[model samples]
Target: MFPAFAKYRQSFLIGLQSNLVYRMNFAVRGFFSLFHLAVVFILWGAVYSQNESIGGFSFGQTLTYFLVMLVMQFFVGAFNEDYQISEEIRSGLINQFILKPINYFSYRFSIFLAARLVTGALILIPLLVAVPLLKDYLTLPTEAWRFFLLAPAMMLSALIQFSIAYCFGMLTFWFLEIQGFVILSMAIESLLGGQMFPLDLLPAWIFNAAKFLPFYYQTYFPTAIITGRIEFAAAIQGFGIQLIWVLVLLAVNQLLWTRGLRRHTAVGG
Candidate 1:
């Protein structure tokens, strides 16, 4: 069992090393991300200009929000694994993965984490270079504990999202196709997950309701914690919400994996 995880870690490390060997690939990704940042800046800049304040967020505050959002985006936005399960199922690769002497979840998770490390580093360097100019607008949290607590909170979000996404991917066992559904989920999360705008800009009813949803904790709550936008009490409550969602997704993914594994009759099996 221990060696199984070790193998997964080895695979992940190999992935990082492989990516490093292909420096141009990382360069291309980083270049595209910079263009994306420019687009976000322009769009948000226009929105801020339209309104004196968008739901209590000033221009600088909103810009800072996007900046932090960009960082979180960099940390987690490498691959879309939603289609990976479907492809594996279609091609019968999943059967091999299951038969291997390893926990499939751990293997998949380690690969995800490893990819994030490489991509995050690639994204951070360029962004950090820009930080000196944007420092006036951005507010790093003053509370030492908040910074410490933020790491695990973000990790929880990453794991929860990966697990839920796997569950969605596992739906491939039942459905022949799931790309449309994946796109829909991505769209809804982007809109409501505080990626485009702060949740505070959303209606009061919607903002309150988001607490129960996983999307809020993904980008909004964690970014708020790091940016010092959330008060200490609210940060605690946000963490609670994030943990609840993590638990719920864990159970859901476990159930999905069990059921899907049983139903899985691979093409080449």
Candidate 2:
């Protein structure tokens, strides 16, 4: 089994080396995150000044959500995967993967893991340094299970995010351009994934509807679970739904990959 995955291991090493070359970029983004966090605190702070709470999140809990979200985005973000895969498809670079025994998705996923690992580490430093300053406003989980369950939730979120992103990138095998799809997806995800605001804070109908989509499990559910924003029953239900979404998205990804490869090969890709 170890020998079978040697190639992916090599890919991971290469990805780490490549990402290291771009270390300054991650460092700069991490540095700027402090400023962004400051702005968010002030903005949310003002909002809570007028109200005791917004959607059951005290001002501190709200801050904690955004802070946790920023960190989560670093670790699970897959924005570049789509563009990279699309470029490979358009430039005929995907032929290399198809001609080889290696799987394109597996190779890309290895690199994705490396990229997130590096990016997350870099961004995490600044956040950690700033964390002490805001420790007062940050809320820890009251329930012991939440502390235990957070890791698995985050891991599931990573798969859900990557599967969806991989499918988006596979669209390039059919469409010459997928910018519209990516942009539209990003907008919907931002709103639905609790980037713009907590999904629970949305109108009841919208909140209920968004939960049916994969985006809900992405950022909000995992962060909410750790923050105690949800109850134990809800958390358990979310894990089940999260697992289902993973299976569903993986199936979709497999379907897209199979069909997309046939189309590409048919056209001499």
Top-lDDT candidate index: 2
Go through the candidates in order and give each one's C-alpha lDDT. Answer: 0.76, 0.87
lDDT of 1 by residue, 1-119 (tens): 67766798787887677656755676576777667667876887788777887766676777777777877875765256677656877778878878877667776677677767877
lDDT for 154 (candidate 2): 88
Give the TM-score comparing model 1 with the true structure, all chains together: 0.88
lDDT of 1: 0.76
Q: Which stretches of candidate 2 lie over 4 Å from their true place?
A: 265-269
Q: How close is every model to the real structure, measured as TM-score? A: 0.88, 0.93
Clashing pairs in 2: none
Candidate 2 local lDDT, 1-269, one digit each (tens):
77759999999999889988988988888898788888988898889999999987799888988898889888887757888889888888888887888888889889889999999888878987988999998887677899888889988999888998899999998899998999999998888899887778888998878777889998888888887778898889888889999999988998998988888852566
Model 2 is weakest, by summed lDDT over 10 consecutive residues, at 260-269
